[model samples]
Target chain A: MTTAKRDTYTPETLLTVAVRIFNERGYDGTSMEHLSRAAGISKSSIYHHVAGKEELLRRAVSRALDALFAILDEPDAGRGRAVERVEYVTRRTVGVLMAELPYVTLLLRVRGNTTTERWALERRREFDQRVADLLKAAAAEGDLRADVDTRLATRLLFGMVNSLVEWYRPQPGGGYEGEQVAEAVVRMAFDGLRSGG
Target chain B: MTTAKRDTYTPETLLTVAVRIFNERGYDGTSMEHLSRAAGISKSSIYHHVAGKEELLRRAVSRALDALFAILDEPDAGRGRAVERVEYVTRRTVGVLMAELPYVTLLLRVRGNTTTERWALERRREFDQRVADLLKAAAAEGDLRADVDTRLATRLLFGMVNSLVEWYRPQPGGGYEGEQVAEAVVRMAFDGLRSGG
Candidate 1:
């Protein structure tokens, strides 16, 4: 409405708006017009920040992928028994997912409808393969159960971890802390869910 | 195309086509024109099968919901010890999810943008609550671990179970059978993924 309001637009602020709309209406369904309307900026101004909707998508998924891949390079993720390293990765992943919920949420929901989406999917698969190899190593070391297929187990583990995006809402004032959740995931995953384990 | 080919469009077959399109292009992104094209029929012909795209959505989600709700009523889900009953429901949930993969995928992905989607979401929450109650009963009976929140455990359990839709392609001839996948899910959820009990 005013010059001052229009002057406030930045790439970071615009991206936050874009990611929210992308998650709400879906990446394929959203248009530059939709992002313009949601961000309260003109389409030309948006182009000043990023080339187009796809670039915004690329930035968003890259944030998620970077955080995820960074977990693998951490010292804890690199050292210790294969199972402990895998567990360390799992715990840190839950942290990254919660800390960057919206970005990771968008990353997971990309269906490969565009070039950017396909890239996200490929990077995601690379991350999963890395974790699966860790699970296989843990299995070989007699830490993870050998009865279940490694790839399948890896999918299920991440499935449980990723399902957080579907239902986990951060409550800063009260309710389960993220640490509590990470611990719960570790326990249910490593120790089993049944009593007397 | 021959008149005979055009005449072969049953409501059932048309739904198969509609759901595939809906899953491909999201429900909001799809149109009657798209459905007509995908179904290989005229717009009027598609109208004759159902009222509109919403009807197709409703039918597809209802199929998934009915299958899932039916699991709760099975003898194994009802008659066993609380923990055993919870495990039975979990295993059967995996089976139904695999059996109705596309429909369930659509159901899980619904964002409640339309009346039909909202109804689907409400029904889904009700289904989740029923399973949560089973987990609570198991915890109350001292069969499930008490330290973790029952609700969180329920979500994680179904998270693991529902993740099947993300990456469980059925292979009729050589790959894992439905029963084997079901057994794997049960083993993972009940006993945990550790090497030894």
Candidate 2:
């Protein structure tokens, strides 16, 4: 393995590399050796920064979960009418997913085979339920359409948002900004796709 | 492993078990031994049904890809106006997703670690592009809103459709059938979530 540059290897930096590998090889398929090889550092050196692979998985998922849960606490998320609050959460959640793309990608792919994954899945459900409550309230307040089920609506809305991880790639020369993507998402989710209907 | 139920194994039956394990352990992490253990059959029996693990992956993804591609050839998809055709594809795509849930779910999660995965990814891209073409045509006809980018809208639309694999569990007692889920998806995607404009 190429171990030429070894001056800067913090937990965060190591995490950036680890998350990429985790997404590529998968969390279960990845190992310390893979990390060491990819990081260009010895396994012992990697151990100095974090406990082991599970810690890396935990940290990566925690970062994603923290960002997602934090959106619920934002001022707009908390202060708005239920419908607006749902929109706010939807937009901000897109922002978080784009900003923390790799970490969140890893987060979404967890299959709950391990304790950490189970915890992540549970926390994810909690987040979904919290957002579902906003949708439910919005429906009750006559803000949202009455025809669609609130629970199903909530999943589909976030499904659109969460689907960002699959195809979104940040443009290098400022082609598509996060706010622009967020705007499109909010518009499409709220407005029917048909024009001038 | 318990090998009690060996009399009723078919390629289709074995695929159901293998896909579940593939989803749980992931494609790269899972091995023939895992399949054997999960299916309560020897590795030899698994080989008899399918060539190996990659064959199973190919079969599962082919089932999904076939269903998706078949949507493009439907009379509504080809004959209707672009906007209606888009809606037609969207509604039918959701049905295909629900009908072939596990197969499509496995298809979506492949990460291109192996040749089979790379092929699956390429085929998936082809499917996405075909749907995207319909979206572009709809936008050209001024049916879809002009504000949102057509490509982004396509992704978001299918994003909603694809997200079905995450949380949709079929109800046993005639609750929330596939058609109901498909209807809700079409409504949510086309109509703005907010009450009447």
Candidate 3:
């Protein structure tokens, strides 16, 4: 690679390339050599930025996990009735998934084959549990349907949110914004898809 | 291998073993040798059952697609109010996912790396479109909410239904039966998660 390109490569830039390759090829299927080739930098240059491929995986998922965990710390997520708080977190989560699509995609697909992946899985479950607790609190307040299990409801709600990674490509001309999609998710999820409620 | 084990290895049995391996180690990571080792059969024996690894993948995904597409032809799916038909299809789709978990899991995870995977993805899109049409018909009947886009609603609806593949394992004592989960899915999808709706 040219000195110009090599000089410009940073950990964040390298991570963007690495996560793309990881997502294209499964994490276990990718190699450091592949990352170097994709990033247009030497393996040594990659090592200079980080320890190895696992480090990159860790950084990428950590970015996603950090963003997700940060949502719980937001003022809206913290305040209001439990039902309102659940709605706020749900809407904010759709926004996070859309904003950090690639990183979160990689985070979601980890199969726990390695230490980094296992850690990512644990963090993901922790996030799920936090949300599940919110649903439980809502249920206790008589806002959530008592007929449905809160744990199951939590799974289905986030399931719909997480599936965006499978099909939610950003529009070319800003046709559908993240807020609009988030609104659609909240509406269908909370208000039901059928009309005449 | 024992003569008894070799004698009992039907094509159906072999597909079961192959799908397990493919899901554990992704389809790309699996080999005929891996299949042979996992199945307690020789490479020649595996070849005797199917032409190659891709053939096994094709068979596995075709089973899932066939089961899913068959839902549309059901009397319940075809003959009811548009809203009720959507609910029937949703509930039956959940039952199919639960009944055929491993096969559908493999189908959902295909990344189109091979021709078989590409074909599987195309059929998946077709299935999604069929369901979207059902949602559109329901909207025209004024049974679905007008505030949300029908196409987006269809995606979110099935997105919740399909997410079961990620986490809906059959309980050891039949704790969560297929029909029960289907009921839960239909109720949550059609009847709003919030209470007093």
* Candidate of highest DockQ: 3
TM for candidate 2 is 0.89
lDDT of 1 at B165: 82
Residue A23, model 1: Cα distance from true site in angstroms:
1.6
True contacts kept of each: 0.65, 0.83, 0.75
lDDT of 2 at B11: 93
lDDT per residue as tens, model 2, B1-197: 48546547999988999999999877877899999999888889888888899999999999999999999998999987898888899999999998898999999988898899999999998988888898889888888877868877888888999999988877789657888889888878887788886
Q: Which regions of candidate 3 fall more than 4 Å away from where they truly are?
A: A1-5, B1-7
lDDT of 2 by residue, A28-143 (tens): 78989999999988898999999999999999999999999999988999886898998999889999999999999999989899999999999999999999999899988998
- Model 3: lDDT to the true structure: 0.89
Residue pairs in clash, model 2: A190-B192, A192-B190, A192-B192
Q: Model 2 off-target regions past 4 Å?
A: A4-8, A113-115, B4-8, B40-49, B113-115
User: How much lDDT does each candidate structure score?
Assistant: 0.88, 0.88, 0.89
Interface RMSD of each: 1.5, 1.2, 1.2
Lowest summed lDDT over 10 consecutive residues: which window, candidate 1 chain A? A1-10
